[model samples]
Target: MKKIYILILSLILLSSCKEKLTEEQIIVNQNKKTIDSLTYIRHNLHPEYLKSDNSELVANEIIKNCFSVLEIDRKNLEAVKDLAHFNFEIKNYKEAVHYYTILIDLKDDLNNRYVTFYYFQRGLAKFHLQDFNGAIQDLQQYKNENTDKRTIGYSKACYYLGTCYKNINDQSNACDNFRTYAENVATDEAWNLVAGYCN
Candidate 1:
């Protein structure tokens, strides 16, 4: 009788452990399915294909699907960034700012380079939305963190920072950044800023 009671207790403990493992496995499988669906959408939905009238509807549907996935899994960085870029391409600057803000808030897990890109893009979106001071803060953060002054991003940040300052009537800082941008990049836009504001 004693031996039987001990055996029954051991079996009960084993069964409880197995139930816990099954619950964990179910959660893992659900997460995997969500990730897999997101991956499929990302692979199939190129923003370039959205330009044509014929494909615009399909592209919008794909964007909706991406949004759905993002709603469920907010930490999916690639999908978030893709959505941000897509919004920016479509001239939805406010939406781009929203998505980029999400990415910016995830500072702990992201690389510095990616964080800088987020700041740059978000700053551009904010500028388009007429939030000049917000734009300046993000653009300045990118400039301070990014070491490579030769990249197009650096020049663009400088140009925009200069423009933001000019808009706010800060000619001194405006000319300073615009001059730096002109010295490094010779784009038509940069030259226009130099002629119009920096001079």
Candidate 2:
């Protein structure tokens, strides 16, 4: 009985030690994976390498890898922004909306000019996703804050806002936004939209 007790106690000690080692190893492995992923992105998705023929493929891979990392660490804003931008660039509007939504909620600093840009991009994503009301809200928010009417962003926002309003049967608001867009951008498309929708 004494020998059996000693063996059991020793087994328990070894088990506890193994558990501790396993926990430490898990953390170390996670850190190593993060480092490896960041390094891979730096090499494969850098601006210099992005001009290559395989840039789109490389960007898709990076987005996949970044999403995995983001799953482990959702608060990584860089990963979130990268996912949002890459998805937008690839015209994966659904994924762009997902990441931008996450980024908007997680982002701490919203006082800069970039805040309007984020709203505009997210609005466009929502527009592509067919969430017209949500798109209107986001685009309107951006329009309210962005004072530079000469910017391409402002024109796009107005155009999309008009589109969103028209889709939702808000013809009055649609006409108003279409007029604003036409006033800011003297393009044939803008004028045609204003004529067709605003009249």
Candidate 3:
């Protein structure tokens, strides 16, 4: 009888000392809150694409998204230049000109060589738009800055300048520029065309 009484007392003590359930429940609840916060952040900050049927609308939407997120101050000038290239691919010539101008301005900040690539592209656009005088000016700039005489671009610039001058009825200047192109980067086909036509 004494051993049975002791055993019952021990069982009563053990049961009374059991931990409260609140602490365990709180940890699980806290973890759930953390997950919910993460989910909210993920949904809020993630980029969403526009649903559009038109190709041009879709392209404009993408460009808008790109402009919003682009960090111009983050030393990503090259990225800005590449965005101009993308704009050109989409046939947004005016927008391409804008971006290329911005990129050209950034060159001073980067302290790099002043590239005439933007001028060349912008000149091409102006040429297509029949802004022959503007095209001629930009092509001249391209030519003046060109240090290498052997480059394909140099030859092209010379030929374009000749064409522009010819359009303006300055035959002497046109002949001179075309002759320079022929002498310098003269591959047979391009040179022959320039020589035969400009002469």
Candidate 4:
């Protein structure tokens, strides 16, 4: 009788201890909040794709933050990628290539999609440096590794391949790639290249 009573008491205690579920609660504020420095920097990085006005002091501050983050965590991939992009945005192609090379070399838990883009970015940097052979290699590798064929990136890659070939005076390959770009994106520039290069 005593054991039965104790077992019943334990069952009641366990049931009482069970957690109760509650509905999610959300709070909304109508006031406009002040923009922080990082937010401002990120916003500015877009629009023009960071193609201009990036040599200013405010832009340098973001680069400094990326470096500061890396100082604490050397293998921080986001910081490394940000550094690469910031340098590129500022037209510091040499530094962009350096950091992008590091990004390519560093191992991470992320899917390879971002890594593939690093190759494309590095290729563009090499192109800016007029290293046509190196740019061709990187851009080709990116094209091969990428699984999605219909994105804007693929179109840009095709366009760049044609430009690279044109730069090197490889007329046949330039015609082939420009036609490919024209068929997919149908941009005025691509059509012009096809007309000018491909008979």
Candidate 5:
């Protein structure tokens, strides 16, 4: 009986060591990826470094870090979302898309409103990149989900949808959307976009 007890204790110790090793490996890998991302971003933004072609490298590192951190600490959705936005600011649209996609996927898991804002932000980026199909897709998704009738989101969606239609020469649809935006927002920017583009 004593020998059997000792055997069980040995097995427990072995399993614990394996778990610790796995956790340590994960931590080390995440740190390395994060360091790589930070270094890439710094070089890209540094005035003296001017000629780096590391956008793909930086994007990969950020996506890896964001995904790994998310697996461990999903409560850090805000941090992950911000990192995604940082990608967008640098015109790293693919990276931005990846991050936002993950963020939206984890919305129920994180129980956060991040996806709402990202919907709009990603829409704008897609629009500027002339991914008109993608822009319309995201904008329409946002408009469908956002039920805040008293806020500005509804109106912005209308304006963006109008812009998307106008870009594609769907003037009739553009006019309808512009009318909706003008009715809801009444802001200078929204009004100007409508006036300049709509017939």
Candidate 6:
């Protein structure tokens, strides 16, 4: 249905711009529309949205669209990121890790300040997958690059690091990270973690 819609739209556009635009330009315009549609769906979907009966259908469409976008350009950053985040949101941690790896490989094409959180996000995904050592490496890099210790990003990283460490029986590191989280977040839950384990 979407393919037909796009084809019709492309034909209309191509006909209207026949003298002014080339075939490749028309195709690019069509691709942009597809990507915009995908972005809209991705942004509008809440975590709870998955409870709907159509949720799996919508998710499958998005996954298919993401792969279609990637087929056009493997290094297409937005497509790769959307796919990575989509998988992560659905709790498909392994696929999230795979796509995040591709995103990380594109770091040279990204702004340093903007892309730093990719590490933190991928670390969390790895943590969910129980890849504790990989999560530690990514989260540690995120911590090093993200100098603002007061932000939620740092606090969350500390929290996850503590859990990952605890999972691996590294009590000392776990306590230290929990203490850091408690200091920065100051949430009751964070303090409880510190008290329950660090103290």
How would you encode candidate 1's per-residue C-alpha lDDT over 44-74 as one tens digit per residue? Answer: 6564365556455555655676776666687
Off by over 4 Å in 4: 1-55
Quote model 2's TM-score. 0.75
**Which stretches of candidate 1 lie above 4 Å from their native place?**
1-34, 47-59, 187-192
- Clash list (residue pairs), candidate 5: none
> CA lDDT, every prediction?
0.84, 0.83, 0.66, 0.76, 0.73, 0.83
Q: Which ranges in model 6 have alpha carbons more than 4 Å from their true place?
A: 1-56
lDDT for each residue of candidate 5 in 54-95, tens digit (9 for 90 to 100): 654545555555565556566566447756776786777776
Residues 84-157 of candidate 3: C-alpha lDDT, one tens digit per residue: 76577567777777787787677667533355777777666666666779888878877777778778888878
* CA deviation > 4 Å runs, candidate 2: 1-33, 39-56, 109-111
Lowest summed lDDT across 10 adjacent residues in model 1 is found at: 47-56
lDDT of 5 at 188: 85
Residue-by-residue lDDT tens digits, candidate 2, 119-154 = 899999899889999999999988998988878898
TM-scores for all candidates: the values are 0.76, 0.75, 0.58, 0.71, 0.60, 0.76
* lDDT of residue 133 for candidate 3: 93
Winning model by lDDT: 1
Candidates 1 and 5 compared by TM-score, better number:
1
Compose the digit string of candidate 4's lDDT tens values, residues 26-68.
1111111112333454666544444555444545677876675
Any runs in candidate 3 off by more than 4 Å, and if so which?
A: 1-65, 71-76, 111-114
For model 5, the local distance difference test gives 0.73
Better of 3 and 6 by lDDT: 6
Q: Residue 173 CA error for candidate 6 (Å)? A: 1.2
